[model samples]
Target: MRRLTAPLPRCALVLGLLLTPVGCAEPEKDKVTIMVPWSGTEFKAFYAVVKDFERDHDIDIEPQVTRALTQQLDAAVAADAEPDLAVLPSVGAIAKYRQAGALSKLDVDTHAYVQPLRGLGMNGKDVYAVPVKADIKSLVWYDARLTARPPGSWSTLRDRSDHWCLGLESGPTSGWPGADWIADILLADEGVGPYTAWASGEGRWDKGPVKAAWTEWGDLVAGARKGAATFNFRAATEKMAKAGCSLSHGALSAMAFDSAQVKTDGYTYVPSSRGALQVSADFVGKFTGNRSADEFIKYLASPRAQRTWVNEPGFALSADNRVTAYDNATQGRIAAMLRSSRYTLCFSAADAMDPDVSAAFYRAVLNYTDGKDLTPLLVALTRVQRELGYTHPGSPPPPGPLCSPPNHP
Candidate 1:
C-alpha cells in the first residue's frame, strides 16, 4: 500500500473539524463503492488496483460483499440508492442489468482488453460495462512426469482412461464437473454456433450436437471408467494429483495446483485440435451518476490497473491481452494460451446460462454419467431452455471451426 507523505497544516486540520463533525469527518475525495463477487487474494489484488486509481484520481473506491447482486441491486434501483459501480462476474448478469436499464452509458474503450472480453460488456451502440478480470477455462492439468510429451489427441487421452482419477460430486453443485465435460465436448464438436445458442437460451438440448456431448460422456464413464461420481471438484482434483491421474479436464484453477500447496511442474493449454477452453470474466457496470465512477471505469481498462491484479498468485489472467508480465512460468503459459490463436476461447456455457437451466444441465450430466438413459435428461433440458425466456445476448460463439468430439486430451 502506498502512503501519502506530506503533512497537513494545523490551521487546515482546525478548519476541517469546524466544517465537518468530529469522528464523522467528510471524505477528502468522492467515495465510489463497487460490489463484486471477489474475496481472499482476489480481493486484495482488486484493492491494489483501486488504490492505484485512488492515488491518480480524486476518488475512494469501497469494495462491498457481492452475495446478492441481482436482488440487492434491484432493491437499490427501486430505492434510488444504488452504488457507484458493480463488477458482475458473468456475462448473463451484465446483459440482464443492461437490458433492464440499470446501467448508465459510458465511454470506456473496451478494445484495450482482449477481443472476446470486449463482447461481454456490449449492449449494441452503448458500452454498458468493461471487463476487469478473466479466467481461461477449457484446460487440462497433468502430472508433469506422465505428460512429458503430452498426448495430442482424444485417442491418446482415453488410452490411459483406466488411470484417470475422476469425480463429479460438488455437494449442491456436484453436477458442475459433469456439465463442464459435456460443455467442453459441445465446444469441441459443435464449435461456437450451437454451443453459444445453448448458453443464451436459444439452443435446444435434443439437437444432434447437444446429444453428442452427453453420449460421449456416457461412453467415457461406461463400466466404471468414472468410478468416483460423489467427490466434489476440489477433492477430485487433489485425489488426481495424489494418485498420479493422467489428466484433469478443466482450467488451470480447476486443478487447484497452486492452492493445493503441492510441488509440480506447471500446467499448459491443451492444443485446440484436441480440446476446448473457457474464460470466466469479471465485467464492470455503472449505476451511480458520478463522473468518478466513469473515470474508474476507464482506469480499469488501463494496463496500470490490470498489472496489479495479474500479480496475485493463481489470480485469473487479465482480460487485457496487451499486458503479460506474470511472475511465474505457469501463469505465463495460461496467459499465452489466452493470447494464442491456435486455442479455442469459449465461456462456461452453464455460467452464461440461466441458473435453473444451468442447474438442470448439471443434474442431467450427473444422472447420465451415473448410467441413466440420456433421452429423458436431454428432453428435460430442452424443455427448460425453452422455458428460460430471458435472453443473454453476449455469450460468445465458438472461436474457430468446431472439431468433432471424442476429444479426450
Candidate 2:
C-alpha cells in the first residue's frame, strides 16, 4: 500500500481551472469506468492500482469484472454502453475499433514502449491504445531443484525431454501454450518475416516449417511423458505449483509461480532464433457515456500511475520501463525484455475469427497427442484461415532497430 508521491496537489488541478473568480465554485468530479479482463489473484492485484487512481484523482471508478471478457466488450460496443477505459487482450479488436472511429488517439509520447505492443493498434497512424502491460512468450521456466543449468536451445528442450515439463492448463486459452510452441519452433527454424507473414494471413500454415513445428511439438508430447496428453493443464500446473516440476515454456506472466522450491533458476528466455515475441496490446474499451475516460487513459500513461502500478501486486508487467527499474528481480527482467526485444510478435487468437474456429486450433493440438495425423489438422486450419481471410495481408515488415530477427541462444 505504498503511495507514490502525488505530482501537483489536488488544488493545482482546481487552481488551473479559472472557471470562477476567487475561491467560489467546487472542483468538477473526475468520474470514470475501467474494465479489467482478469480474475482471481490477478484481478485483485490490478484493483489495488485502480483504487489508488480513485484516491489520487478524486475519481470514482466503476470497475467491472467478468470472465467472458471479449464478449463483454462486444456487448458493450453493440449496446453503446462503452466504458471510458478498457484494459483488454484483443489487439485486433482495438484495430477494428480504431478503424471504426470508436476510440480516441493517445495524446502522450510513446517512445520508450516496446515495438510489438506499440504495433498492436493504429489504422495507419491514429494510435488508439497504450500498452499497459505485455507478456513475453519466449521464456522457458525450469525448476532449479531439478537441473542447475538453464536450457540454451530448442534442440536441448527436445533432446532432453526427460527434464522438459510443460503446463497447458489455461482453460479456453489452454492451447495457446501449444501455439507458442509451434510459433517458437518456426521462428527458430525460419525467421521473423515468415512467422509474421503467416500470422497476418500472408503465408500458408501447411508449409514445411509450420508443419515441421507441429511435428516437433507432437514428438515431444508423445515421447517419454506417457500421460502428457492427459495432463490437464490446470491440474498439471497445480502439480507444478505444489510439488515442484522440471521445466515449462510460457509467457513472462507465469513468472509469478516461481517460489523457493519452484524457483526460477536456469531459466533462459530468448527469441525462437526466428525473432518472434508474442505480445498483446492494451486498448480503451468503449464503456457507457463517460466523457472523462480519456483523462484516465492519460493517467495510465502518467509517470505517477506507471510508477505506482509496477509496485502493485498481481501478474502484471509495466510497459513503462522507468517504473520497473526499482522492481523485484522477475519484474525487472520482464521489463528489460520488453524494452530491448528485437520483435514483439502478436498472434491472431481473439480478433481474427469466431471462438469455434479459434478453439479448433487448440483442439487439434490437444487431441493429436499421440502424434496423430496433422495433415488434416493443417488442412482444416488452412480452410479456417481462408474463411477468415487470414492469409497474410502484406503489411511491410517491422522497421528500424526493432526489425532485427532475434536469435535464441
Candidate 3:
C-alpha cells in the first residue's frame, strides 16, 4: 500500500506558483534597419517620422547615420550585410544598385507624386525607390537689411560677387553647391532642351551650353574661392552678416537658419528666374526584402507622413501633391511653387548622372574653383562620358525626360 502525499501549505503553494515560469513576457517587436546620410536636425526630423511608424506598427527602427553613405553602402552590399532599406539622394545610385540586382522592387503607391518624381527610381515597370524628401535648389537667399532688392537677373547677380557668400566643402560631396549653380545657370541661360540633352549625356560637355554655364559659374564665384573650398557649407550662411555677404544661393534647407527663424532672421529668398528650377529628392529603397522594411517605406511615402515631415524644423519639401499645407508662410510659398503648374522642375543634373561621372563632376568643380583651367576639365569629362557610352552618336537618351515641362505633373 502506498502512503498519501502531504498537501503543501497555502502560502507555500502560492510561492511555488509565483516562482514557476509563465508566458507573460512581452513578445519581441519586429525590427527594420535603414542606412541614411542625415545628421543633426535633419536626422531628428526623419526620426520623428520613424517614431510614428514604430508606434503605429509595434516595430523597432534602427537608423545607421553616416556622411560617407555611398562608400559604406557599397561595402555593405558586397559583404551581403546590407540594411533593410537606405535613403539615397543620388538617383544614379538607385539605378546602379537596381541594375546590379541589389535592390528589391518597391510596391509603394506614387500617384500623389508629380511627374518626374513619380518616374524616378523606376526600372521599367518596377519601382525600386520612392522619394521621401524633396528640396528646391533654385533659390537665392539674402539678408534683407543689407540688400535693397534681390538681383533681378543672372548678370546682375554675377556682378555682385562681393556680396555673394559661397562654401563648396561638404565632406565627400564638397563641390555639389557649385554644381547646383552651374546647372541652374545652364537651364536658365540655355533653355530646357539643351539642359536635358547635356544632362542625359547626349550633349558634349566641352562645347556649347555646358562650357558656357561652367565659365559663368567660374566667373561668379572664383573670387570667393580663396577660403570657400575648405569652408563648410552650413557655416556659409551663419557667417554672412559678419563677412558682409548679403546674398547666398542654395536651397532653404541648406541655410544655417532654422525654419522658425527664416522670417524673423531678416533673411528672405527669391525663386531663381532660371528657366526651370533645379529640384532634388532623397529616395528610399529596399535592400533585404524585409516585409517590415516595405511597410516603413510605404509609410514614409504616405501623404500623412509627408505632411508631417514637411512641418518639422528641417525645411524639407514634399513631392506628394496631397501635402499642401505648411506651418509657416515661407514653407507655404515654396510648397506652392513646387505644386504650381506655372514653374517647371528639373532634377539636379549631378544627382542624376552616373556615380563615377558625378564624382568626376564634383572634383572638376573643386579644381575649377581653385583656379584650374576649365577646358581640360571639360575635355576629361567628355572623355569619361564617351567611355560610359553616354556620348555615342545616335545613342538614346536616358529613359525619362530629365526636365519636366510646366504643368506636366
Candidate 4:
C-alpha cells in the first residue's frame, strides 16, 4: 500500500483506484476528512501531513479546502453533515463552542508539550485543538545591508530613521496593519493589563494608554520619515528583500527567505523587534461519530505526528513542541523570536466584533491617507469601539459605575 504523508496528489488517487483489487477484502474502514481555512501553498503544505496521517493509520482521508472555513463549518453543522475535524483560527469561538456543546474537549495529558500551550486549548481548560502552524507577529524584519541593527522600542523605531518601510496597504485588511500598529504601541507602552482590559471590552478607548497608542501611531504616520500610503505589504516587503528598504514589520510567515529578489543576509529578526507578539490561534473542531476520531485527535497532539506534520521542514512554526522542528537560518531566527514572546495576544482581526465595525475602522484609516482629521477618526473609533463592545481576554469584568458612552459626530 502506498504511504500517505502530505496532501494527496490527484495522480496518486488515479493510481490507487487502478491498483485496487479484483476479489480484495474491503479496505480497512478507517476513513476521515479534515477541513482547513487557508488556501494556495499553505493548503498544499498542510495537505502533506494529511497524506501522512492516512498512510500510518491505514485510513482513507479526504481534505475539504475552503476560504470561508467558519461559514462552511456552520453550514455543515446546521445541515448535520459536518466533517470529522475542522481547523479554526479563533480561541474565543473555541471557548464559546465548548459552552455551546458544539465541540468536545480534547481529553488527554499534555505534560510533554510546551506549557504555554495549556490555555491555548479549550476554555482555559479542555484541550480541543492541537496547534499546527504558528507565525510570530512581534518580529521586526530589517534590511541588514542598510541598518545592520534595528531599533528596539517604539521610541527608537520612530526617532531613528536610519531606514524604515512598512506596507500598511494590505487590501481588505489594510486597516488591520494599522490595528497592529495600535496594538503594539499599547502592549509596549502600557503592558498587558491595559491591553487585556481593552481586548475584553471592560476598558475605555479614550483611556490614557489607549489614547497614547493611537497618538503614537498618528505621530509615526505624520512624522518626518513617511511610508508610501499606496504601498501594499508586498511592495514594502519587496523593498526590504532587495535591501532598498531599511526595515519592515510583519509576521514570520510574511517574508519567504528564498525569494529571488531578496538578499537573505540583509534581514535581521527579533522578538518584540516590532512590538509585543500577537497570535492568530488556529484550531480544529470535531463532529465525526467515528470511534477512531479520538485517535486522530490524539495523533495530532502526538510527538511523532507533530514532528512530521506541524514542525516539518518548509512549514511554519507550531505553537507547542510536540516534537523538534527545523527551519532554515532566517526562518529559525523568526521562530526564535516567536518562541520568546513575553506578551502574546490575539490579533485584533480575531477580536469579537461585527465585521462592519472593523470595516469602519479600515475606512477611517484609508481616509486618513488623504490627510483627514485625526479627531474625527478618533471619535469614530471611540464610537465603533463602544458599539462593537471592545474587550480583553482573561480579565475580571470592569468595576465601578459605567460611564456615559461616547458619541461620534
In the order shown, what is each candidate's alpha-carbon RMSD?
8.7, 10.8, 3.3, 11.1
Ranking by lDDT: 3, 1, 2, 4
lDDT head-to-head 2 vs 4, winner:
2
lDDT at 135 for candidate 1?
Answer: 70
Clashes of 2: 19
Score candidate 2 by TM-score against the native: 0.77
lDDT of 2 by residue, 1-409 (tens): 2244465566577776764564576777777767777766666666766777777776777777866666776788788777777775655556556545667666655555555555454445556677775556666655444454544567666776344555554645556567667776766666666666665555566767778878887766554344555565545544444544655666533544643222233343434443445544444544344556766777776667766666655446666556655345655665566655454444433333333445567677666664557898788887776665433243122211222222211
Error of 1 at 389 (Å): 4.2
Which candidate ranks first by TM-score, i.e. highest?
3
Q: Which candidate achieves the best lDDT against the true structure?
A: 3
Model 1 Cα lDDT, one tens digit per residue, 33-52: 88775555667778888878
- Model 4 TM: 0.74
| Residue 388 shift from truth in candidate 3, angstroms | 3.3
Alpha-carbon local distance difference test for all models: 0.66, 0.58, 0.80, 0.57
- The number of clashing residue pairs in model 3 is 0
Better of 3 and 4 by lDDT: 3
Candidates ranked, most accurate by TM-score first = 3, 2, 1, 4
Record all residue pairs in model 3 with backbone atoms less than 3 Å apart, i.e. clashing: none
